[model samples]
Target: MTHRVLAAMIKHETNGFNRTPTTLRDFRDQNFHLGEAIPRVYRGTNLEMGGFLAAAEREGWELIPAVAASATSSGPSTDEAFEALCMPLTNTIRAAGRLDGVLLGLHGSMVTASHDDAEGEILRRVRELVGSDIPVVVTLDPHSNVTPEMAARATAIVAFRTSPHTDQAETAERAAAILARTLRGEVRPRVVLARRPMLTGFDGARTHHAHGPMPDALRRARALEAEDPGVLCVSIHSGFSRSDCRAVGPSVAVTGDGEDPRFRSIAESFMDECWARRGETTERVLSVAEGIAAAREWRPGEKPVVLGDYGDAPGGGAYGDGTAILSALIEAGIPGAVVANIWDPAVAAQAVAAGAGATIRVSLGGKHDPEHGGGPVEGTARVVAVSEGSFVFKGRYGTGTRGHYGPSAALEIGGVTAIVTTKNKGIYDLEQLRIFGIEPTAQSVLAVKCMHGHRAEYEPISSRCLDVDSGGITSGDPLLFPWQRVVRPIWPLDPVEGGTP
Candidate 1:
């Protein structure tokens, strides 16, 4: 008998510190496709849904696409938006009558105004509708906060092992394979989770395997699966620190066939390794002044220095309007320095009105929160170029997806040129700069508003990459934000003695 499977994706990584409330328009702006529309847009792409489509074709399974929705990482999603996204998935499952299994693409750090553990709640609703007999397999980002509720509801949870998240398609394929095996009665999958009392940011999660600890942990996970026949899949989640929820921390999930005592031991061992190297995981960041000084020391013949403003990374729910680094670079008169970019719609509008080559006086960036990044910088700038803001990704992540930054302009203030845009986006590709006529390779310094996500693209062309602590909502220092939800007694917040909670 040909098996039928229901597939959908609803993902968003929330940052409680952000004041903006995510709405339905955000999902629409990013991607919101229903049923057949999903495959049409995602087919042959690097997205997780593309993998599901490929798996369906390869396995000869009847695939019923429900809805594929996601928004840029931001503040907690509005209750209405959350319900609207979930309704389509649940409604589709209820109307389908019967299914062999369910496959989902989820970001485990989702937070809505009504629920802290939104992914878990989504799984519960799906479970209530489909019942426990049907296997439910989910593919998640490695940065997810894998909750116990989520682990309990899912038959098997597969997450990307890479930090830059180049393995989205591979992770989804693994989840699809697990679901197929369960449907064929080849294996009964069960997931076991173990978490450490540690909370670290993105710096330590880099998966190059040469310098970072994450690669070693991943190797251990792979070895355990190879050693034990019962082990189906092992995922290590670095967890999103921006999410100030109770389940905010790194964890390890071991999926295996039926109940196995070894699963717990393996998971615990993985968590132990993470806890043991907790100190090495935190990133050592430089201040805006230090970053500018480093740029000043660079020579023209050497490869450009990439200065990452991690605090203002839109991927981590920051406003992307912080002006600390930009103002400092301009003040220091760093020649051939290009910042890609500052999110200021008003300034972009002014530049467009002035047209190219017209000099205009404007206050740029730091408009969202003055207290965070020293307010906006008011100065006269020469508009070098203006664009409607549209480009295609050539990077590992979102390789084929189209990106927009709204009305944008290239402004030259003193010696530094800044790309000002109406919309906020984390730097993911060289195309973001190249489209605006700013060649990153030619510049002496490329200041990017991103975290580790930019490393995949920038590192290849850069002589050196440095993370700067230009204060914003996404600051690397977790202590800067006031926390009310996450469980207490976590590392850096409190003392972790003997590497145990």
Candidate 2:
């Protein structure tokens, strides 16, 4: 008999320091597809929704798609946006005559205005409607803050082992397979979690680092599953520390065959490793001046030096309206440099109005909070190109996915071209530049507003990549933000002995 399943994607990575409140419109600006539109938008994409769709076809399950809504990282999500994401699933669960299993795609770090542990809240509601007997398996981002509530509610949980998250679809497939096996009575998986009192760890979950903590942890996790028949899946969440929630730190969840004492032991061991390697970090974030000097040193004939605006990473809930690096480039007169992008809808509008080749003086970026990534830079620029700012992803990070930056314009100032956008989203794919007629290989410097995800695509084309501390909400240093919500005595926040205190 074919099993009936309910599937949905509700995801967010809240950055507590950001002032912007995420709303439904924000989800629409990034990814929002309800009912049938879910398949239309994400049937073959590289997201969790795509994996669920594939599972339905492969397993002969009656897949019920409810809603897939994910807003870019920002301050706490509004109650309304949270409701919009949960209601579709709840409404569908209420109406669906029966559901054999539930497959969810969640970013384990959602902090809404009403609830700090938002994904836990989503699972709580799901359990409320479905009860505990039915199987519920979830796939989470590697950066999720895996709470006890999430581990308790979920029958099985899996997270991307890869940091650039190149394995999003693969991670969901693993969760779906576990659900399938449980429904078939092949296994009875139960999840157990263990976390340490730390703000961050696991080398920021960078799988690209061959000797990083994540690679070592993931190797051990995979070995556990291979050696032990009781272990179904092991998920290691490095946690989103930018989200000032109590559970905002590294955790490990083991989905075992049954209620085995060994599952908790496995999770505890993993957490111990995380705590032991709390101080190990692979990337070094340099100051704005250092990034500018690197850009200035680049020659015209060499591969572009990718200057990363680490602090103002949009993917980590930064406002993305930073002018620190842009200002530096202008000050140093670094010719043949490109900044893609600086989020400023107002200046983008002005560029769109002025049209290509029209010179206009405008203040760009740092509109959200001048105290963070520097105030706006006032300058005259020639509009080189203007676009609707929508494109398809060709990078390994988000292959087969569609992305939009809203109205965007290529403005040339002091020989440096800036891609100004109406909406803020991290730039990971080279298609972002190709859309504006800027080839990634041709530029002397490609300063991007991104965190680590860009390493997947940009690193190959870049001669060298340097992390820049522009002082936005996504700064690598956790001490940069004012902390009030996260549990006290956490690592880097207060002095804590090893492991759970």
Candidate 3:
């Protein structure tokens, strides 16, 4: 019998400390394709949906595309936005007569205004709609906070092993393949999850294998799967620390046959390794002044120095309007320094109105909150260039998608060049600078507002990279934000006992 499977994707990583609530407009602005439209747009992209289509075609399974929606990482989603995004998928499932299995692409750290465990709640709803007999498999970001509810409801869970997440399509294909085997009665998969008492960022979770502890732990997990016949897949979720939910922190999940006696121990050992390396994962950051001083001393013939403004990472729910680093670079008189960028719509509009080659004085960035970063820097700037804020990504991650910065402008203020945008975007590619006529490879210093995600794209070209704690909502130090929801006794926040949660 030919099997029919339903597939959908609804992904968002929420920052609980962000004051602005993500709305339905945000999803619309990103990409919200429903029904047949989903495949038409996403089938060829490097996204998870592309993999689902490939597996369905290869396995001769009937694939039903439901809803595929995603928004930029931001604050908790509004109730209306959550319902709007989920209803299309749920409604589609209700209309379908029968199905052999289900596949999903989810960011495990989603939080809504009304729900803390958003991904778990989504799985529960799908489980209710499909019933228990059908096998459900999901592909999640490694930074997901693996919840018990997610483990109980879904038959299997697989996460992208790479931190910069270049293997999204591969992970999705694996999930689809596993579901196919389960439907064929070749295996009965079950998920075993374990959590560690740690709340750490991705600074040390680099999957380069030679560089960090994350790869070694993943290697051990892969070894466990190879040794046990029942073991299906092993995943280490480092967890997104920006979220202040109860399930916030690192976790390990083992998916295999229920009869496997080794699943629990294997999962525990993975979590234990993560717990042991807690100190390495903790981020050490430099002040903006210190970062600029180092950049200024770079000798000629050296590779470009990349400065990461951790606090202003829009990918971590920062407002993207922080001006501290920009101010410091300008004050230091660093020539050929390109900041790409600061999200300030007002300044972008002013630059557009002034036109290229025109000089104007404007207040740039820091319009969100002064307490997060410093207040705006008022300066006289020459409008070097302006764009409609649309370009295709040349980075390994999201390689083919067209990204928008809304109305944007390149402003030359003294010795530093700043790219100002109406829309907030975390830089993960050199094209973001190239589009504005700035050549990143030739620059002396490239100041980007991002964290680990930028490493994949910039590190190859950078002689050295520094993480600057410019003090914004997404600050490397989690203690900077007041926490009320996350579970207690998590590492660095509170002491753990006996190397366990």
- Alpha-carbon lDDT, every model: 0.87, 0.89, 0.85
* Candidate 1 residue lDDT tens string, 88-144: 999999999879899999999999999999999999999999999899999988888
Off by over 4 Å in 1: 201-203, 499-501
TM-score, candidate number 2: 0.98
- Name the runs in model 3 displaced over 4 angstroms: 201-204, 282-284
Q: What TM-score does each of the candidates earn? A: 0.97, 0.98, 0.96
Residue 289 in candidate 2, Cα distance off native in Å: 2.6
Model 1 clash pairs? none
lDDT for 233 in candidate 3 is 92
Q: How accurate is candidate 2 locally (lDDT)?
A: 0.89
Q: How well is each residue in 1-501 modelled by candidate 2, as lDDT tens digits?
A: 879999999989999888889998999778888888888888877889999999888999999998898888999999998998889999999999888999999999999999999999999999999999999899999899999999999999999988688888888889999999999999999999999888888877878777778999999989988999889999998888999988899889999998989888889988888888788877778999888877777887889999988999999999999888888888888778899899999999999999999999998888888888899888899999999999999888868888888888999987789999988989889999998999988999999988888888998898898889999889887767899899988888888976755
Rank the models by lDDT, top first: 2, 1, 3
Ten consecutive residues with minimal summed lDDT in candidate 3?
201-210
How should the candidates be ordered by TM-score, best one leading?
2, 1, 3
State how far residue 248 of model 2 sits from its true place (Å): 0.6
Error of 2 at 267 (Å): 1.0
